[model samples]
Target: MNISHLENQTFNPSTFLLTGFLGLEYAHRWISLPFCFIYMTVILGNCTILHVIRTDSSLHEPMYYFLAMLALTDLGLCLTTLPTVLGIFWFDAREIPFSACFTQLFFIHSLSLVESSVLLSMAFDRFVAICNPLRYGSILTTQRIVTMALAFAFRSFSLIVPLPLLLRRFHYCRTNVLSHSYCLHLEIMKLACSDIIVNHIYGLTVVAFTVGIDSLLIFLSYVFILKTVLSIASREERLKAFNTCVSHICAVLLFYVPMIGLSLIHRFGERAPHIVHILMSYVYLLAPPLMNPVVYSIKTKQIRQRILKKLCAVKLIQT
Candidate 1:
């Protein structure tokens, strides 16, 4: 455990080992099968969503545009860790180059931030559509949507860039073995031989400013949305308006609840079991991408009908 002796050594590791599941080494191959299925589901589901939105002219509004952006970010987030995860579990390919590790860390966290921003944007869309239906179209124009997309991308990228760069400046003289299948900011930071106070402060600051603020604003938007929905004179109209938001609410909860749980475990669960960390990480990473498409398909009538019609057309062609 004493890594201080390594400080004087000239040899620096250029690669790090990723231990997929510490206690389940014997069943790594079997474990990989389920992960493979999850990866396929995420990719295919998100791709289908994007294609449906693109081909259907009726779905060209700002809401669908934001959903499409969410799908894109989900795809990015899933793919960022899939390869390394499967590699470790299936082939025992655990050696990751230093640069590659940082690159993966950057994408995984940056895309997560982008997804949070997209959720916030979606919340705004709902607030406007329900609160000011008359001016929803005028307020969320195509140009404005495009600008918001650019801003989301820029904010995530700019905020996450310094993380990897700062990490590079440190010499990781400690053990280069990672607990999970992928590189994470805090996990890697813990291996540094130098003082990491600045890294910790910056990481917390970024999360507070980005995901923290996004979650808060999303809550506020929904509060306003609920108030507006309640003002409807007819019970049926209130139900219909509230129903429109159900899918987004589920998506937000799916994404944030596990994320918050994982953060809590990392900070407070000092003596928690290893399996707890692995399971929580899986929930945080896997659930959102897999559930988002399913939730939307089941909740949105237009998307559901479009999907069924396409399926029937394919069945007819085969027949």
Candidate 2:
């Protein structure tokens, strides 16, 4: 197995194999049924959210704007994950090109951070609406939302840009079998034959600065929001003020719980079953996008009413 001849040139493989759920090869097709359904639901649900938000003038506010951003990010996640996931489940097409693999990994990681950023923005939005109701409009104008969106996207890209390049410098000569259907930075990095201390450091740094800091900010924003809500004397007022935050709290939990679960499993579940890893990764990728729209639509009165109105209009037209 001496790749001595590769020393003259380089030893980068042309493709990396993506692994789906293991020991369930007999049920891969059955597994694909839920995945297909999840993909379709994500598309329909997020598209419905985007359409509802765009077409309704009454819904044009900072809250819905951030929700729209969330929808877009969810769609981005869906697109990035769908190809490799379905490829593995349905077609057994797991041999992703090195470049394509890196690109997929980048978007998967980047969009998660963007989603984190959006959630943080939404938290702040809640804090403003609850804690500073009078000046909310001035603080979170459309212009500022756009600016924040741009800044978040750029920050995610900048923080993640080094990953592929760092990975490129290493020569991967080990088994290219990856644990999940999609390319993950750590999973791929593990295949390299060289020292990966730097990669590990940089990866940890990115997670800390992006997801760590953002989640902390979101928690603090909610603390302030809770404090403000408590100051309101009337029980009715307290409930009403707290109600505005319910959808956001659900969204945050949806996005972060699976994420934190998967992270913990990766760090501490080394002796755990491989299927546990695959299942955790699946939840990490699929749950948030598939569930966010449902949560928001059910929780947010305006979005629910708008969706119902649109559905009724369609029904009337069809009739």
Q: Among these predicted structures, which one has the highest lDDT?
A: 1
lDDT values of the candidates?
A: 0.90, 0.89
Give the clashing residue pairs of candidate 2, or none.
none
Model 2: lDDT to the true structure: 0.89
Q: TM-score of model 1 relative to the true fold? A: 0.95
Question: What are the models' TM-scores?
Answer: 0.95, 0.95
Tens-place lDDT digits, model 2, residues 66-137: 999999999999999898898878887867888999999899999999999999999999999999999999
**Candidate 1 residue-wise lDDT at 222:** 89
Give candidate 2 regions above 4 Å deviation: 1-12
After superposition, the stretches of candidate 1 with alpha carbons farther than 4 Å from their true spots are 1-12
Candidate 1 lDDT over residue span 187-240, tens digit each: 889888999999989999999999999999999998999888888899999999
* Least well predicted 10-residue stretch by lDDT in candidate 2: 1-10
lDDT of 1 at 15: 76
